[model samples]
Target: MSALLVAVLLVPALGAAVIALFPRGRDHAARVTGTIFAAVTLIPIAVLPFARDDGWTTYSATPTALRPWTEFDVSWVPALRLDFHLGVDGVSYPLVALTGLLTVLCCAYTIGKVPSGGQGRTLVALLLVLEAGILGTFLALDLILFFLFFEVVLLPMYAVIIGWGGDDRRRAARKFVLYTLFGSVLLLLGVITVAVNAGTGDLAQLTGGTGLSRSTQLAAFALFAVAFAVKAPLWPLHTWLPDAHTQAPTVGSVILAGVLLKMGTYGLIRIGVGVAPLGAEWAAPLLGILAVAAILAGSLICLRQTELKRLIAYSSVGHMGFVLLGIATLTATGLQAALLGNVAHGLITGLLFFLAGAIKDRAHTGELADLGGLRESAPRLAGLLGFAAIASLGLPGLAGFWGEAFAVVAAVERGGGLWLTLAVLAAIGGALTAAYFLRLLRKVTHGPTGSASVPAGIGGAEWFAWSPLAALTLAVGLAPTLVLAATSAPVRALTEALR
Candidate 1:
C-alpha cells in the first residue's frame, strides 16, 4: 500500500518529464503520451480498494514533511519545534482519487480539442505538474508541506490560463493569481502561527490539540477560515472564479471545477475544523451566515449571467455554499453531506464545463443570446447539455440531489431557531439554482433557434470529450453508493475527531 501511494505521486511527474522531452511537433504523439501516462497513473489508485485500511499508522515522518512521494521529517526551526512531516490518511483519500480522475479526464479531453500548435508539450507538462500539486495538497499531512503543494498549483494554472485561454486571458489570469496569492499569504501566517503556538507542525499532533486556550483557537480559526473561504470562493470572495473560468481553456476549466476548488473545503476539514473543534463550534454561526450569503449571492449571479462558462462558474459558488453550510452545522450528517457534495459537485460541474466548451466550439461563442436552435441541429450535444444542466439543478435521483438535500436536512435538524432560518435560506438557494438552469435551458436549447449562424451539433472531438463525463454522471446518479462508500470510512473518522 505504501509503495502504491508512492507511485501515485510519482508517475505523473515522470510521465510529464518524458512528454516534455519528446518532439513538440508531434501532436498525435503528445496525445498518446498524455493518455497513456494518465492511465498508468491510475494503476496505484485502482489498487487502493484491495489495500486494507492500515488505520492510523504512525511514523517518525521524514524531512520531506507532508510533500507527497517525499516523506521527510526534521526539526526545521528548533526553537519553534516545527518538524517537517507528511503522509496521507483516510480523510485525504477521496480527494486524492478525485484529483487523479480529473487529471486523466481533462488530459483525455484536451487532445485535438485545443489548437495543435506552439508549446503543446509544455502545456501537457504543466497540466501534469498541476496534477501532482493537487494530489499532494490532498495527501499532505504536514502544514508546511501542505502549503507548498497548495501554493504550487498557482503557477501551472496561470500558464494554462495565459498560454491557452481565451480573449482577455492575461487579465483573467492576473486576477486569479492575485486573489489566490493574497489568500495564500494569510494561509501561510495562519499555518506558521499554529506551528509556533502548538510547538509542532504535525497535523496528528495538532489534531490532539496542544492544549491551546479557546481564545487562541478562535484566532487561529479565523485566519485559517479566511484563507480557505477565498479558495472556496465563498460569496464576494468568488469574483475571480467566473473571470478565470470564462477565459480559461476547456481542460483548465474542467480541472478548476473538478478538483482545485475542493482544496479550500478540504483544508477547512483538515485544518480549521480538525485542529480547532472548539473554535469551529464558536464560529459555526458566523460561518453559516457567510455560507448562506454565498448561496444566495451565487445563485442570483448565475441567473443574471449571459455567458455559458461564467454562469457555470457562478453556479459552482452556489454549490460550494452547500458544502460550507454543511460544515458549519458541525454534525456528522452535515460533514458527510459536505464530503458527498464535494465529489458530487466535482463530477457534475466538470461535465457541465466539458459540455459548455463543446457548445462554444460549435457556436464560436458561449453567450446565451448568441446561441439558439441547436437541438434540431445537434441532438446529441443538446441532449447531453440538457442532462448535465438538469443534474446541476439538483434533479431527483441524480448525483447532485443528495448533497444539497442532506446539507439542508442536517442544517435544519442540528441548528435550532435562527439556524433553521439560515437552512431555509439555503433551501431558497436550491430553488434559485433550479430557476437559472431552467432559464439556461429556455435560452440555449429550448427557445426558437436564435440565429442561423449557430453551428450544427457536436463532432468527434466534442463527443469523445463529453461522453465519459455523461456516463459517469448517470452512473453516480443512479447508484451514488459507489462514491459514497469510498467516502464513508473517512467521513466517519473525521466526524469522530470532532467528538
Candidate 2:
C-alpha cells in the first residue's frame, strides 16, 4: 500500500525525466515516452477499488501528521515540524484517480492531436511534471506538503502554454503566473497562520483540535478562500481563464479545464472547510452570493461568445459556480454535489476541449462565423461536437446532469432562505447553460449539411482519443452511485468535523 502511494507520486516525475532525456530531434520519441509513462501510472489507479481502507492512521512528526489513503510519513524539516507526508481517503481518492485518468488522456491527445511544434519535447516533459504535481497535491495530507505540490503545478503548466501555445502565448503565460503567484502569497500566509496558531500543519490534527480562535479561523479561512477562489477562478477573478483557454494548445486546454480548475474546489473542501468549520459557516452566505453571480454572469457571457474555446472557458465559470455553491452549503448533499460535479465536469469539459482542439486543427478557426455547416462535410466531427455540447449543457443522462441537479437539490434541501434563493438562481443558470449550447449546436452542427465549407469528419486517432470521455459521460450519469458511494463516507467525515 505504501509502495503504491509512492508510485502514484513518483511515476509521472520519473516519466518527466525520461521524456527530458529523449533526443530533441526525435519528436515521436517524446510522444511515445509520455504515453508509456501515463499508461503505466494509470495501472495503480485502476487497482484502487481492490485496495483496503482501514481506519485512520497518522504518521506524525513532532507537531504535524500525514494521513493518506494508506498512511506514509517521514521527517523532512525538523525545526518547522514539516514532513514529507501524503494520504487520501475516499473523499480524495476519486479525484486522484480522475487526475491519473485525465493525464493518460492528455498524453494520448498530445502525442497525436497536437501539431508538430518546435518544442514538443519540452511540452511533453512539462505535461508529465504537471501530472506529478497535481497527483501529489491531491494526496498530500500535510499542509506544507500540499502547498508545495499545489504551487509546483504552476511552473510546468506555464511552460506548456508559453512553449507550444497560439499567438498570445507569452501574455497568457504571464497573466496565469501573475494571478497564481498573487494567490500563492495569500495561501502561504494563510497556511502559516493556521500552522502557527494550531501548533501543527497536519490536516487531521488541526480539524481535531479546538486550537485556533474563531476570529483567527475566519481570518485564515478568508485568505485561503480567496486564494482557492482565484484558482476556482470564481466570478470576478475569472478574467485570466478565457485568454488562457483560448490561446492554449489542445492538451493544455483539456488539462486546464478538466483537472486543474477542480484544484480550487478541492482545496476549499479539504483545507478551508476541513480545518476551519466555524469560518466556513461564517463565510457560507458570501460564498453562496459569489457563486450565484458567477453562475448567472458566466452563463450570460457565454451567450455572446463567438469564439468556441472562450465560450467553453466562460461555461467553466458557470460550472465551477455550482461547485463553490455546493461547498458553501457545508452539507453532505452539498459536498456530494461538489465531489460528483468535480468528476463530471472533468469528463464533459475535457471532451469539449478535445473537440475544440480537433475543430481548430481542421477548420483553422474556432469563431462561430468561421464554423458553419459542419454536419455536412464532417458529420462525425459535427456529431461529436453536438454530443459534447449537449453533455456540457447538462443533458439528463450525461455526466453534466448530476453536478447541476445535485447542486440545485442540495441547495434546495439546505433550508436557508438565502441559500435556497441562490440555488434557484443557479437553476436558472442551468437554463442559460442549455440556451448557449443549443445555440452552439444550431449554428455549427445542424445547418447546411451539404456545404463545401465544412471540414472533414473525425479521424481514427480523434475517435480513439474522444471515445473514453464520451462513454464516461454516460456511465457516471446513469450510475452516479459509483461516485456517490465512494465519496460519501469521506465527505460525511469531513462535514462531521464542521459541526
Candidate 2 segments exceeding 4 Å error? 57-68, 208-210, 448-454
> How would you encode candidate 2's per-residue C-alpha lDDT over 114-211 as one tens digit per residue?
55455666777788898888888888878999999999999988888887889998899999999999999999999999999988888767753358
Clashes of each: 11, 4
Q: Which stretches of candidate 1 lie over 4 Å from their true place?
A: 53-86, 452-461
Candidate 1 on 94-118: residue-level lDDT in tens? 6777788888877776676664224
Best model per TM-score? 2
Query: TM-score of model 1 relative to the true fold?
Result: 0.92
Instruction: Assess candidate 1 and give its lDDT.
Output: 0.80
